[model samples]
Target: MEIPNRGKNIMKTLCLAIVLGGLALSSALQAQPSEDTVSVPVSARQLRIDLPDAYSKMWPEDYRDLVANYSLSNGQTLSIISRGTNMYALVDQGPPHKIVSTSRNNYVALDRQLKMEIVLGGDQGASGSVTMVVPSRSLSDGRFVPEQVVLLAFR
Candidate 1:
């Protein structure tokens, strides 16, 4: 009789452990990023850049952390947040514009009312990475037509 009771107790304990384990797994799965969380589709792709004649060495080196490369699919106003590396003149347009550090993490508006919030994989890797920001709105916009991020490394 005692042996049978012991076997029953062991089975009950095993069942409880299994049930608790499954509950924990379910909670973890729900905590993960939802499908709505947006992320850039490309990090390995390069960007096309057109620098004006006024590129200064101080410009690229000083603002290395915030500097980025960008391309325009349509001929429209490209608004970039004022950063140290933002120094660049328009191809036929004019000179580079560098603004205060206040704009460091702000929006850089590009064509089609599309805006960019700078993307550097990590703070440490930003200097070397050819990071750029594109407005989430333009992700599905019809104006820009490029198979992939265009590679335009003028540096």
Candidate 2:
């Protein structure tokens, strides 16, 4: 009958439409970048430094161990702690990165595994404010060259 044929055609068309829609959705998802591949904006919460308790435990009497505290733009905190000749950048309660180099008011810390360097610099004597520079590349041809740099100021 004509009615039966019409119903069959409508069902087939619906099935094809569903299949095509699914394929389109799958392709769109595949085209999107993964979380790891996506780069975080500079305004995001980049610097998270946490103060360590061991430093305090080591020298319970010396309250001067906490060198300075900085407030990031994203409402996060960064702390610089010193223990004798060694200095550390305590980030988000994460493992401390030793302050490798320093020049005047600038302090440089390197995370070799991440291939990134964090530089903190300020004009005043650890009082006014600090500028944090995160560079994605290391030194090239004996000079520090960065492919991408993110600058965050501490207030």
Candidate 3:
């Protein structure tokens, strides 16, 4: 009788801890996007959030519109598809683009046509915009150079 009672008490304590932990986690996740969701740009397919491991992990079931097929500034349309766990960008008349690097809310893609690096991320300056950086031509000293940076944001 004593042994059974002790086991029951231990089980009860464990169950209580698990329940509390779950409640705390649920609240934290809920608070993340409610404040910013309204500010997301209309053209933006999804929140400018970094996947847990660069699409190596499945997207949350609650997220919608996992794919973004849009035209780049260079007049080339790139199609990026999400297979729930990973994303690949299909370049026009070129090979599929792989993720060069990734962070919490940003990633870089290397393109062959423009032969430059593109950075996509959330814009801290704008409440509901995405930041994009592409190559640009500028006069440096006495000659033209491709070191200029251009920022295109979607509001």
Best by lDDT: 2
Q: Find the 10 residues in a row with the least total lDDT in model 2.
A: 51-60
Residue 131 lDDT, candidate 2, scale 0-100: 33
Sort by lDDT, best first.
2, 3, 1
Per-residue CA lDDT of model 3 for 1-155, tens digit only, reads 35565344333333443454465557556656675453333553321223233432325341223355545433444555655555555544445554433443344444322111233443532111122222233322554333222222222
- The candidate, 1 or 3, that scores higher on lDDT is 3
RMSD of 1: 22.9
Q: Which residue pairs clash within candidate 1?
A: 88-96
Q: After superposition, how far is residue 138 of candidate 1 from its true place, in Å?
A: 28
What stretches of model 2 exceed 4 Å from their correct place? 1-66, 112-149
Instruction: Evaluate model 3: give its lDDT.
Output: 0.39
* Candidate 1 residue-wise lDDT at 131: 18
- Tens-digit lDDT string for candidate 1 (1-155): 35565344333333443454455556556655766653333542324333333423435555555444433322222333334445332211223344322234333222212113334557443221121222122222354322222111222
Q: Which residue runs of candidate 3 sit more than 4 Å off their true CA positions?
A: 1-66, 109-155
Candidate 2 pairs with clashing backbones:
48-91, 48-92, 49-90, 49-91, 49-92, 50-90
lDDT of 3 at 112: 22
TM-score, cand. 3: 0.30
